[model samples]
Target: MGFIIKLLLTGAAAMLAAYVLPGVSIDGFLTALILALVLAVLNAIVRPILVFLTIPVTILTLGLFLLVINAVIILLADYLIAGFAVDGFIWALLFSLVLSVITAILDMIF
Candidate 1:
């Protein structure tokens, strides 16, 4: 139940990012929900492997590189889905950060 709420909140955050950032585009609520699910799965699945693979870079960058990884994951999701487009790498990174913060806040509030 809580996980479902989180997904909805995350989708709302993604939609919000699309509104805030010109480079990020979401079709609508349904599309946003799908994108949110993809992002969550990516963060859970691919993210761990990525963290392990990029451990050296993560260490070198003092964990800042994780932001880049987050962006990449978002971009990958955008590419995988229709009507969900992230324009640039940096834009993706910013969008990722905003969505993450929103989800965290929502999690706390709920």
Candidate 2:
């Protein structure tokens, strides 16, 4: 199914990002898949609420604050998932950015 393919792509991107970033690490492919799923769920549920609450700051920052929100979501995933570790907030921010770029590339290719 298309959904399954998308998840696999996301997992691959997560693994690749972790491999590229020393500050982030994922145990294995399965953990990457789980991480992808958790991120999707968090983005679906928590992200909107966060965006809504942070509207003023987001507006003030000209939408750049979304990057911080993305990093916070990554940190939340780090806390919720085992076998996945991000060294710090800066690492989380970098990882989120890398993951987004990798995922975008993968999506384009597939």
Candidate 3:
């Protein structure tokens, strides 16, 4: 299914992020897959609500607050997933940004 494909792509992106970012790490392929699934669920259920609630700040920051939201989601995932780790807030932000770029590229290529 399309969802499965996206999930796999996201897992791949997570692994890619681990490789490219020093402060981000995934323990294994399975952990990456799990992280990807959790991230998808959180983004679907939590991210929209956060975005809606932060609209004022988002507008004030010219939409940059969305990146912070993405980082928060990543940090939440890091907290929930034992095998996934982000060094700190800065690493979370960079990881989120890199993961987005990697996933977008994967989406395009696949």
The full ranking of all candidates by TM-score, starting with the best, is: 2, 3, 1
Candidate 2 residue-wise lDDT, 16-66, digit = tens: 999999999999999999999999999999999999999999999999999
Which residues of candidate 1, in runs, are more than 4 Å off?
Answer: none
Error of 1 at 2 (Å): 1.2
Q: How big is the positional error of residue 41 in model 2, measured in Å on the Cα after superposition?
A: 0.2
Of models 1 and 3, which has the larger TM-score? 3
For each candidate, give its TM-score against the true structure. 0.95, 0.98, 0.97
Ordered by lDDT, highest first, the candidates read: 2, 3, 1
lDDT of 2: 0.97
The CA lDDT of each predicted structure is: 0.90, 0.97, 0.95
Q: Model 3: per-residue lDDT, tens digit, 15-105?
A: 9999999999899999999999999999999999999999999999999999999999999999999999999999999999898999999
Of 1 and 2, which scores higher on TM-score?
A: 2
Q: Assess the local accuracy of residue 99 in candidate 1 as a C-alpha lDDT between 0 and 100.
A: 86
Off by over 4 Å in 3: none
22 Cα displacement, candidate 3 (Å):
0.9
Q: lDDT of model 3 at residue 79?
A: 95
